[model samples]
Target: MIDPFGGIKGKELTNTSGFFVDKEEAIKEVNVSIGILENKNIKKPTFLETLRSKKSKNTEIHNNVWDYVPNTNNEYVNIHIFWSKKVVRSKNGVPIRALKVALVGLKAFYRQINTLKPDLQHPDILECYKLSLENYQNLPPIESFISSEKQDLLLDPFAGVTGVDIYKKYNDLKKDKDLTLEEVKYSINFIDQLELPKSKRDKKFITKKPKFVTFTFPTSESYLNVHLWWAGQIIQTRKNIEIGRTRLALASISKFIENIDVETPDLEIEEIKEMYEITKVKHEPGKLKTSRIELKPISKGGLSYWSTKTHRWITGKYDAKNKIFNPPKQNL
Candidate 1:
């Protein structure tokens, strides 16, 4: 494998100045410094250990490491040192030791990169250090890295709305053309009552369910059909209402549903009945025709492109495609 941080020479690796031309050299210096400290029986401080020292106002021992690493004019170098000291003084997890090690390494790396000859300096050198340090500081708790078999369990006693309910409600509403706004509101409430799944670990905890419940459908057409059906029901409640007025009402209701924390008994009902009429007319049987068309590939440079002519229905047979059937279009 290629070393992303160009490999360093033996002389550069052992250089006591702690400066380096690139990241690889900087990292090597950090590791060597950490090793030297360890060899002298100096134990690296843990996150908790440093936290207790700071709370007690005894951070002198922690500051001793700064005396060994050379300070530099580079902003990233100074910032890394500041963060490293802060991490040692406060922060959590085993990664704090890793951060301290990285800070030691960066001190040498930044020193070299900052002092490099104008032509030798890489544009991304400073950016690489900045991003690396940022990512390191944002590291999550170590336990998050561990895999667990635990899965979320549905807290609700009922199985919640399924595809069966979708079709059943659709068919029932189709037969009963007189759908009241109260009935539509009741259906929305029924769906909202369905609780979201909770983790098994949080079984005992009580939490409020989300305002909306996402119902899954077998197909995209079915999802739209269901929402359109509900839209139609809202439309039915008002007779002789203009399509534009009904559309505005439905839009208002949809917006209102999104913002409310709880359902209101006196919630206003709006219109969408005109949309149902338009959709019903467009989807009428025999209005659309389905036919297969040949799609030939274009040739280039005297080479005939290879493509097989496959038969596919490009339009209209709703029943053949297993889609919802629309009402017959009537002459205006």
Candidate 2:
């Protein structure tokens, strides 16, 4: 008889009294053992496959599994595995076993989607997934997809410092009434002199107008709001020439926020005043008076109102029920 477990040597058959009573019985026992081993070797259904098999039983849970899959350009299976490991270490509410199962499901889904025909694929969903992957491929470290607390640590150079101080400094600068255009210019130059990370250095700050770059921090929104106020001041006072300067200033400030540390000082604040004086002229009776204008039908097939103050024809609304044309009220 053959040795099913491969323990016997040199084709020697065991004696009848050794294990089995007869050669036929011994051969039958060996065959039974081989069949049992083969059954053990067969692969079991993976978690992903199991989920797919029961799709009709629980639709919501199956749909929710997709949330765990990272929408990145990197290999979906690899990224998801890393993410699941991290989530486990963090002790978040998500169960490690569930995450593992979701990962397996994502891998199966990825394979299915890639193998599907283009005509059968969902165009909008596929387009969105592709865009998300492309967008994150070159994402900066400061704008990482990790938790907000981790992102703050990555953004701040100083270990203990955060965005709170930066927010306060901005508020103080905004309150200063002595701020001047020269001081604003000086602050812009100071920010420009500061070094930025290599990845951010090549971005264009001064275009036809000012181009603003967004940063992430605890007080980032507050800082941006004040920054906009400053931009508005510059626009109203200096108009177009200083527009490029404002853009450069915004870019420099963004760099400063990204590289903030304990050594950095409060950004200088200067109040911007109107450059030109305004003179109000009183209107004479004759100057305010105009000739009577004729009301003409609108070529666009609508009722028209003649604006006596502006000396122009303006569009008016017709009241279908009242059979009246309602002209807009004129300001005195």
Candidate 3:
């Protein structure tokens, strides 16, 4: 029987896993990412690259937006875009290509169409058109930026911390005629209203992966244990004292973990005393690469090391709790 008086607890949204694709396979990979949406040739590219670069000096694959050659009998259009990020470094004066790398994230969406000025009026390009740039961010948009189509079932695979999913990569290309999102609204619109937070089972990556416990502590004076989660559960522990500077604080924390009991009723117990050390890079994202970590167990002396690209040290602890949560405080 369940205890009706134990007050149900909720977990933070940051514990989910996220999915992403890099520049090279931007189009194809995004199409094959998770679900299949409407697939078609790009209609009109709000921002177009007028210049083309050669394969030797630059590997820009142009001509994704094909022009219908009026041969009186046939009209064929080919759709395949291959633009290189390296093409930005321009060659001397002769003007090799028009480089407009917008911060809008051109790689995220692939619906493009080039409706040139009716083949009649000849107008010069605007000055602002020549002054746009691209901005690369570390996260994706999970809150403010929304999609329009209402999926039958919505899944927020990764939680709140992502931020790069909003802006389009029109690279310096502005809404000269007030286009892009508005036009996209009619074509492949986004669906933001359908986001459902209650359906999440693991509180992170909207998947059915086995819940792993989280055990967090203050890496500093302000790191909060509240913003962290694991296996979709709240973190409850005895000590949330700050871990201080990672380099010097390791010794004391290691000693603490080596001598703690985690099977108690506290929610944050199982994170101490690891069979394998949880190594971390001084302060860099994905720098430690833990998947390749291997430890040699000698009846437990102190710690172990990953024998590869990283020479950093990390310690892992374990307990009998259902899940662990060791979150650092959310910076104010």
Q: Model 3, stretches more than 4 Å misplaced?
A: 1-109, 112-150, 153-226, 229-306, 309-332
Pairs with backbone N, CA or C atoms under 3 Å apart (clashes), candidate 1? 30-105, 235-273, 246-271
| Window of ten residues with lowest summed lDDT in model 1 | 156-165
The lDDT per prediction is: 0.30, 0.28, 0.24
Q: Between the candidate structures 1 and 3, which one is better when assessed by TM-score? A: 3
Off by over 4 Å in 2: 1-61, 65-200, 208-332
Deviation in Å, model 2, residue 296 alpha carbon: 18
Q: Which one wins by lDDT: 1 or 2?
A: 1
Poorest stretch of ten by lDDT in candidate 2: 276-285
Query: Using lDDT as the measure, which candidate wins?
Result: 1
Between candidates 2 and 3, the TM-score winner: 3
lDDT of 3 by residue, 1-332 (tens): 78686877764432111111223333443333221112233332223332223223322223332222233132222122222222211111111111111111232322221112111000001110111112223323222222223334322111111222122222111121123223222111111111334463234333322111112542332222211121123233223423221111222222232233221212244542111122222111223436212222212332343222222233334333845422222211
User: TM-score: which candidate is best?
Assistant: 3
The CA-based lDDT of model 3 is what? 0.24
Task: Give the better candidate number (2 or 3) by lDDT.
Answer: 2
Quick one: RMSD of model 3?
26.2
